[model samples]
Target: MSARDLVHPLVLLRRFASDMGAAIRVGGVRGGLLATCLLAVGSLTPAYLPQSSPYWVPARALGLDSWWAKALGTGMVIAAVGLLMIAWFNVRPTIYVGVKHWAVLLWWSLPLLLAPPIFSHDAYSYAAQGWLVHNGLNPYEASPSFLPGPFADQVAWVWRYTSAPYGPLALQISHGLVELAGLNPYYSAVLHRIPALVGVALVVHFLPRIAILMNVDPRGVAWFSTINPLLVIDFVGGAHNDALMVGLVVAALYTAYRGRMFWALVLIGVGTAIKQPAILAAYPIAVIGSGWAGWHVRHLARFVVRLAYAFAVSIGVFCAISVATGLGFGWLNAVTVPGMIVTMAPFSLIGFGVQNLVNLITGDPNGQLIWKIAQTLGLVLSAAFVVWYAITRSRTRPVSFLAWAYLAFASFGPALHPWYLTWGGLLLPLSKPSPRVWRIAAALVSVLLVYDAGNMAWRNDLVGLALAAVAAAVIVLYRRYLRGHRPLAGLGYHDEEGEANA
Candidate 1:
């Protein structure tokens, strides 16, 4: 009961945490497994948090979404993700060896896959969209609330009254799940996520090839791309369609690397059918496949011929999907939803800045007007960048160019959702981006996870304050640790020497 006795136990706990941190920092796959186990334990929090039916986890009935639950769950998540970053940087692919070693991540991913949706209920919209497809309704034209059901109720209010802003391929798969699961939303959601699981597997399979194309360590690429807490939380936990979209994009990039232009275009088209931004990937691949990166006139002619063939194949495949699914053109409208909402995206921040300036300078306080103008400016910039990147490869490599384009879209696009980060995150591993870029991405991901709307539901700056504190602590600890210990073999990744051996 004495202060020294209390201090002793606290010291012991700190020692224990320090050991775990060290283990994740330099330990191998075994260390990663330990981190995954802790993350799995934390994953239970979302399942237990109180939610309505169809979104129920075993603990949901206990009404655990109270203030205490929030604090505990959030802290657990922070610890797990922090550990995950450590383990990811420590990965040694050569020691791990082969797909079997990498499959350990999928095992770690399973528990979260079974948990309730964490950050977003877009999966509910997917389920509702699927229900529409099952009933021969166009998801593009129909809202979930148009006919409420177990799934429709779980969708966010903003989306519940709006049509499904997802790919036709996703809707088709969801429709099949709905038909199989009937009116039960839970089963329908799980089934919908099966595709996401497949997507994750695809990412794992192709990540090595992607690394080879970029001439980097597959271990670093795979570790950063697949073994992170964000991928686990967003792809497996939330069942976001971005999972499948990015998976397809990665696969297409791999195929393009192998000079399989026909297959690459087919895959890219299929990806585009899953998400709109994926179409951007096709442009770079088209230029690469057709050898359009060259300056010679004959090269341009060769590029045109090759591009024509690639286009024919992709267009043919897309048309077949459109015909087979009987859902055409409606999804085009769905792609514009993020632009309609004003989120914390860079453009949205610019809009807020413009709105404030207008209010102060002109005594005209029309936030929407400024927001719209800012969005238009962003749209123009993003479009121009993408067009330039696509048409002329110039100094940048094709795949690398596409990756930057994805980042441009995410940063400048409206209503930036956390899940959208996967668009760039998945590909960034294929090649090395600047450390500054990675830090920026980390900051954005941290803010998004902390400010997740479905869970926190607060507009206050509390999350921001907490994130700033965490960032400061991490920086201080890292600098101190580096001053004391041997520098990391690589900065963001583990032993470049060891990974190169893979």
Candidate 2:
């Protein structure tokens, strides 16, 4: 036997175990195995059992009765805290890698892969629009309240009272399904989940491709992109349409990187059909068409031409869908009305300041002017960032484009939802690590928002205290880490080559 073969098997096993322990100390759990599972269960509990359901007895017994939904919300906070701990302690690198690791990851994420549709009554809006189309009424021109059923009035207050601002194409499609399904909200909700799952699946599939295109390690991409806790909880569990938009955006980038410009434009067009925010990706396409290394007037012209083509195709598709489904175009304009903006974690800056200002200036505690100002700032800053990035950065991906787009929308758009931040979270791994503290702070704040959204009573003081504490912690941790203190030594920096370009 060779000298190596002569070594004892137990000795090798012991060495392997030691190395794994060290890796976990550094990288946390690479797949976020345990955290993802906890978050999945925690976030979906409210969906399966309504707040008034008897299943909440256990939660009430545990002091979560103020809002039975808070039981799940509290659990999510604990899971997020666990994730942060894992991240803070740097436990991923030491985690075992191989089929066993992947199995655990899959096991955790699978329960969430298709958990019964829960949270956000937005899906009901989609169902209502579909029902409208089924009844041969233009969904764009009519609000859910105009319909004649319990489902119509059951839409979330924001959607029921507000004019429809969503692109008509998605509504038209949903309406057609409503016609086919005969006014079943549950069925419509399930159908909407199909696209949502498709979006998540697309991300999982294209992530490896994205890593390859960026010349980064596929393993890093797999661990960081597909299996992150934020991605699992926000996209998979929350069932937000932004997840699909993100998937399409990423696919477009992957196609463009492969020189499939035509396909990329088509995908971007489809994404815009789903949500108007996706139109921002056209900028990155223009950048790519102009070539990565040089600036040419001819290239700029070509970029504009490509952009025009994308816009035309997107508009055409949307119009066709509208006409086919009898959903008029009026809904496109309805999405812009000012309304109660929920406090999403990143956008909470506006919520905190605006709510207080309104209370102070008008002596009306429910005033929303401060939110308006915060949104204005968010728009101004986001626009500035996009302009600066276009001028300074050589490589632009769809994720980058979508990230900035969603940031602008969250900041300036009429309403905010904590799950909306999922858009940015999905793309976070693609950006530079310099913003790690801000991102982590955003995630923590999101946990608080989830809690606030679940429990109405906590709106006043509990949420505010939580937000302040999180913000303060982020500031302290950032200051220490910036000084080379290794505040998160167990989470050793795993810098992929050329990541700076992304």
Candidate 3:
């Protein structure tokens, strides 16, 4: 009840950081919690809120619908991302951030968990799809727009008419949540976060165990993967089902490493039923089951047999789930639905650029030649890498190698979302990535966080984007000139030279 009591927490946090001997003047843990709080508050703005939400009227009454208010929200987001980057970079293996950090991570997530959908409205679409199934209409056979009600109204226009591309288990879960919410769209959307939260819990439990299997520091893995800004923002805040899918995939990997291939394959099958990319986890599992020693002609037969067994078991489980849900392979037809969106994936961007260039040169805008070719090439390249990694690195560096394979496919495929990157980035810590690699990954995570907010701003309100850009530029200037290149001195500890090579 006293002012000192209220003030002591931050001071205590600072003291704790100092005791830990962190290299930075401010602890990453503290900064990360602050950033999450900022993001939670900023996420209430019009740019992030669903236009159909009942909160908008109240927001409008408070002048939160104003251009300046949107820009302010954007600015806050930019600042939060910058602070999070600084915090993550300061975490050192020497500090041994372990179980206590889990509490901090959970504390940071509370605000986000209570916030409305932040970066995306996909949860709205999820609710609508569930509504479709509840009404005895197959989601895979129909779009949300077909129903045309409160639920469909909440979906973003781009996906309004798209059939569900998610697996049967995902759709069934959504359907169940929707029914449990009494068919209320907003509540349904909120309830949809259950799967994501469960997935996050799974990751928190299993990632450290997986890290142990790779002979890496559990603290390191926990810090890098669990505290990752991208995972926090997109998976938790955005309420993407990829959270559960990737979590199941991680759990399956752990089970495989524990020498229980049957259970591992079953987990992989369940994960694949949540999202298709999870099926790819079977390759490494198959390699593990084959008892890989060294590449030899004789080993090829065993590898093939193990791979076949994996595929057969996983496919059976996937089919069983499909049959149980009565969704029955309709999702197979909708699997390519995501590719309909022209995103910033490497090949998609290239194809879009070439398509535009061709239109400019020919004065004709209907050509789809180069775009299709580029997309096909991306698929081919992704498949090639999958095969190459499966054959070569599956035995020696299975976790890291498979992580890169997932990332390669996501990056090169026709669609790339920030959450998609988390599928692989979460595994990198277990691989003992070098400091340089960590730095690069940190930079990517920072950019991705900004990109999600900026993209939303650019599409919904240009003024917001401009303000965010200005804020970003100011932060860069401060970090480069005002702060200089020196390590922070007041709080925790970092060894710049050690980290540079670590």
Candidate 4:
């Protein structure tokens, strides 16, 4: 047979193998039994080796620890790789269609939700915030340094070094719960997990509504939002607040699409209160409202009056909450402070490149000028992207606006933690499918977390080399896919102009 004939069968075999793998991983009797075993193992591993134990060494250097913990960690890495492969090949099962498929996904995700949070110390930082709130301090206004005793030691590194860049409301609520529960750190951790759980539920509940509103297939929505290892591992296990923020934003968008404008605004306001990043959703909400009003009103005067009332009600509610909290104006500063730092985010790539150049030229390994230049560029790019999306695309569905806003933020934020992508990942399935792009993006992100979880060096080579290789592969595949693809070409569910009037 010719090369083309041979390749065709090989592709078919590969696709079959992938489908079988995904089905075996998340399907019927055997799959459910395996999921239970995984969940049990995952839950027990955390109990045996708590995050605070010496097993979780800084820089993720695997030291002499319980052999079982090490084995579990290794298993996690392997499972993540396997899941990425399944998603990359689009190995969805045809055996059980529709809700049955989603049911299987939900079952598989239980273990992921139960798995221990990994890769970053942000959860610990959040726990500290709760501890402060329990001690009768306004976490919004008081730094952890002001507190004394065990809690002080726990938060000293973050309190002295890190800025409280998160919005106050969520942390404050967690804090209040910890205090009401009488200052137990363990209990506080549990309370912090509540928001993550709520976020998960919101994703599952609202995804179908969104799919219907956009007139897209709802079959894959659950897998995209819930079954994806990234969502489960980073947002659910890590208990990141981005999950809560995304949940609130999605909820508000769903409400708005249903023509409940006032309620949608209220939900959006609540979301913003949880995290300042949710403010980006306001642009889409306003756009949708304006378009609806324009179509219904005969005169511009009536439309203007309607828009004024909506703005008044939304702003009034937000201001009232702000005043009640005594948070003052510090939350505004928190929103902007992230732009001033330099780290792994895409915006910092230019900074990294410039810093290397300066070090090579001046023999000064630390060049302040190069650092400043990079930060300036990143800020400018981020601001410009946000402005462009708001002005040009605000009248579009909130999902599209949110997708772009999150991509911009993830690319431009000073520090791009894996969890930061949780926001965008939550929304991507709702937008256009560029499977090759998303697959590569997902694989690179997973690899980064895996490498970071491993020690910084393995056999004297940078452990991140493996991650970099994966990222490069993904980029190549994405470029190939996009060779003749327009940016919004396949975004068929919703029109950029407007969807069919309900």
lDDT at residue 482 of model 3 (Cα atoms): 50
lDDT for position 499 in model 3:
16
Model 1 lDDT on a 0 to 1 scale: 0.65
Deviating ranges (above 4 Å) for candidate 3: 1-27, 91-99, 463-502
Q: Please, what are the lDDT tens digits per residue for candidate 3 over residues 389-412?
A: 766556666676678898888888
Candidate 3: the clashing residue pairs are 21-493, 22-492, 22-493, 23-492, 23-493, 23-494, 25-491, 435-502
Candidate order, lDDT descending: 3, 1, 4, 2
Q: Give lDDT tens digits, candidate 4, residues 102-183.
A: 3444555565454444434455557667776666666656666776544444442534334466766777766666676567
Q: What is the TM-score of each candidate against the true structure?
A: 0.79, 0.70, 0.87, 0.74
Better of 1 and 3 by lDDT: 3
Report the CA-based lDDT of candidate 4 relative to the real structure.
Answer: 0.58
Candidate 1 structure quality by residue, lDDT tens digits, 264-378: 9899889877877777776666765453445678876876776677667776777678767888868667666766666767877888777888888887765478787787788
Q: Candidate 2's C-alpha lDDT?
A: 0.56
Residues 195-248 of candidate 2 have per-residue lDDT tens digits of 666787787778667656665445544555565545555556556677788788
RMSD of 3: 7.1
Worst 10 residues of 1 by lDDT: 493-502
Deviating ranges (above 4 Å) for candidate 4: 1-75, 84-91, 94-102, 112-115, 148-160, 180-182, 292-315, 336-342, 356-367, 396-398, 434-497, 500-502
List the global CA lDDT of all models.
Answer: 0.65, 0.56, 0.77, 0.58
TM-score of model number 1: 0.79
Over the full model, what C-alpha lDDT does candidate 3 score relative to the true structure? 0.77
TM-score of 4: 0.74
Q: How much is the lDDT of residue 314 in candidate 2? A: 54
